[model samples]
Target: MSAHGETPHGAQGGHGNLNQLMAGFALAALLTIVPFALVMGEVEINRTALIATIMGLGGLQILVHLIWFLHVNRSAEEGWTLAATIFAVLILVIVLAGSLWVMKNMNENMMPMHDMEHHMQMEQMKSLQSQQG
Candidate 1:
């Protein structure tokens, strides 16, 4: 036991592991800046590709943060954490994909097939002629 009356291996009294964790978090934060700039900047990224890349990278960042900051690893509740992570990811993918599919179908089915402005103008003209006559 150290002067602080705690186990040396535990995180409470040890600065080394804490410092390493802090550094990892800082690096992860720094890494995210590039993605932020890419998203915010005027560069024309292909919409579908960009969406896919962003999703993939965002998932990767989440995993990194889980490992570095949350300490979800082989040594830390290994099987349960892994199972939970997989289940969460599976649910997210299912929901997102299902919503996208439904939205695409709805857009295709409900969108106007003709020029809306032209249709509205013709209806207005007919109404005016009926009123005048």
Candidate 2:
């Protein structure tokens, strides 16, 4: 029994100090600010590279929150936090992938106005040619 009440045995290492918390906050802020600046500012970057950079920063920000704010270390709750994190990540991946796939298929199936007009014109031309012949 310590001053902060009776913490379970072997589960006392997750709580970080003030300095560590501040460092994590700073890192999270940097992770956020850089992307905001990149998108908001006039910095021209390749679309793919920009997306990759933003995603990488987002992952790092998640790590900082898990370790610092959430205190989701392996020692906490006998690895339950880690397991939950893994499960959540898995669900997110599945949902995002499925949504993208659905949208792509829908886009391929749906024609734009221009394409529809062109197809209609071709059909009318074929009908006229047949009537003349």
Q: Can you give the lDDT of residue 63 in candidate 1? A: 77
Runs in model 1 deviating more than 4 A are: 1-16, 75-77, 102-115, 127-133
lDDT of 2 by residue, 1-133 (tens): 5676755443456466689889999999999999999999957999768867887788789888987888777764549879999798788768866876798799889999999999999999999999999
lDDT of 2 at 86: 79
Error of 2 at 57 (Å): 0.9
- Residue lDDT tens for model 1, 12-51: 3243476778877786876687668778984697977776
Residue 31, candidate 1: Cα error in Å is 4.8
Please give the lDDT score at residue 35 for candidate 2. Answer: 93
lDDT score, candidate 2, position 56: 78
Please identify model 2 stretches exceeding 4 Å from their true place.
1-14, 99-133
Q: Clash number for model 1? A: 0
**lDDT, candidate 2, at 94:** 86
Quality of model 2 by C-alpha lDDT: 0.82
Q: Which ten residues in a row have the lowest lDDT in candidate 2?
A: 6-15
Q: What TM-score does model 2 achieve against the real structure?
A: 0.66
